[model samples]
Target: MPMGCPFLSLRFSLFLSLSFATSSSPFSFFKLQSPSSSIPKATSSDLLSLLASPSHSSSVNPSVADELKSCFKFLVPFTPINTRSSSDFKSPSSRRSLLKSLRDEQNELIWWPPEPVLELARLAFDSGGDPDSIHRALDPTVMPVPDVEGSKEDKCELTRTPYGRRFISQELNSYLEYLFKLIVERGPDVGLKVSLNRYDLFHGHLFIATETGRLGILFHAKEYPLYDKQVFPYYLGYCQKDSNVTYDDSINLRNILWLAPLPSNSTQGWIAPGVLLVLDAHPGGIVYRDLIPEYVNVVRTIYEDDLGNVVVDVNYLNVGDSQPDYQIFIC
Candidate 1:
């Protein structure tokens, strides 16, 4: 188990007020509420249990339970961890101040897709194996191609599109395949298998972002500049190393996928979910051990009541590892 590594099993306890007003919608009570002393503090275990069996929980009000069930129905396809032993898990190290600053700065530039694209994606998922729906969702008009420049020396011949450059139709096809393998067809034992040769498609800047501050799937590409300019330099300075190094020098931002929550909301703060694929981070070295826990801490802190009380299960497969390892964080 990855828990043996110590770093992989990081836990966090975040206390927030749960006093919320009841919404008109049957399951809209998950909305964030004002501070109240009457309600009991909800723990990670409490939320996880509710997700496992929403109808049976008596600890929370029926409205809250219903809302949580509705919000997390998308998680039905994921494998549930029946037994969690936190004895081996340690609290993530203190990087809160640094993360807060990053959140505040990057929150300004967070992006989302148009409503039509999101609707198409939803249609595709709902329609299951319908090729037309899938094609509509993956279409360049619905899914904007990344604005990247390509070179003749590149391994594959690049085709220029109005939005960006890609290798014929391979990029879109690969992205569709990746979505099915990583999310749609995911099962108890399935983990995203990313071949190094097709790293661009498998480990690209594609991510799932939520309006309620949740940044799902992968890291936002807009934050790449933040890391390259500020975060990376600070890390080098902390180690008393040369400060001239860039983020790309240490790890390829393109190859790293971050699944967490946004520090805050975007301009249009309505509750909507969208997929963002920004091809900016150039491929580089492997992600470091310390960085993963840093991201987990960010997720634990930034995730508010947008989706109600929920647990985030993060699984990663590093090069040469026998199998993918995982850790669970409550958000």
Candidate 2:
């Protein structure tokens, strides 16, 4: 495992104050409460139980229950039934039957929140252990929309329109932008002050998958202050690949998310994990046939940077057919 850099040590924290208003949408049932308020925070076990079996809890709001059911239905295939000690599965056949039933229950037309956003909701649940936070994280209205046209200089100059743009909806785009901002905002504190570039070129699709098993948008270089000349050189070096692969031929900006080293448990060396969240839902997948090598090459370069490189593991999680794909690259 890679360790944290002493020069880039910083703690990332997300502070959310949730307040809800009544709306017809299923997600509107989540009411926001301040962290400082008297309401007790839900434990991890409590949240897992609610997500695993929302029907059993009478206190769960009807609308929220409906949403949880949708999420549960979507997550069933990817969740490992055997590892769940709390589940009362009698045999392998019963587990398979249940999974099949869950898959059959899925409605093709119903709109569920994007997989990356849902994964972020899961992460929020794990960190804060609050059900409301999960809903708040999935709420599109609360997410910040990226100002693509406003910040041109800060963006990387792309040779062409991103391949994944067509598949991403406006709502999903906002959610991806929100995630980029959150990561940058919560990134390690180095000597420099990190900020969002707010450029569309900084955002694209990497042909990657999210936790829900669907492709997602890539938010590259969200933390690096692109305007700074000293920092810009490193950004260019990071993107530099083989001479045969031109800027147009390579996955230049697609893989670079945050440049700063994040806090990690390992004490060996600096560990900067690059996360790829695929939100695109096109059945045919987005990567151009010729550019597939570019994507693989970038991942290869990150892992095998030095001659005596340490072994780094990349974890992937997939769920439903339409769910987004999620991958974590520790470099």
1-331, model 2: which lDDT tens digit per residue? 1111112211110001002212332221122222353333332122122322222234544443333333221211223222223234222223333334432433110112334433443343234333233234332322122222222233321212111111123443354444444434333221111233222123332221111112222333322222222222122221121112222212222332211111122221111212222111111121211112222222111211211111121211121235433322111
Candidate lDDT (C-alpha), each: 0.25, 0.25
lDDT by residue for model 1 over 1-331, one digit each (tens)?
Answer: 0111112221211111111212331221122332454434344233333433222245556544443334232312222221222221121122123445643323211222223333333443344324344333332432222212221122211111212222124433343333324432222122222231111122222222222223334321111112222232111111112222233321222222222212112222222212222111111101111122223221111222222322222221122334432211111
Highest TM-score against the true fold, candidate: 2
- Lowest lDDT 10-residue stretch of candidate 1: 10-19
In angstroms, what RMSD does candidate 2 have relative to the true structure?
Answer: 21.0
All candidates: CA RMSD (Å): 21.4, 21.0
Off by over 4 Å in 2: 1-82, 85-156, 162-169, 189-193, 198-201, 209-218, 222-331
Runs in model 1 deviating more than 4 A are 1-34, 63-181, 184-297, 301-331
Give the CA lDDT, 0 to 100, for residue 221 in model 1: 15
Per-candidate TM-scores read 0.23, 0.25
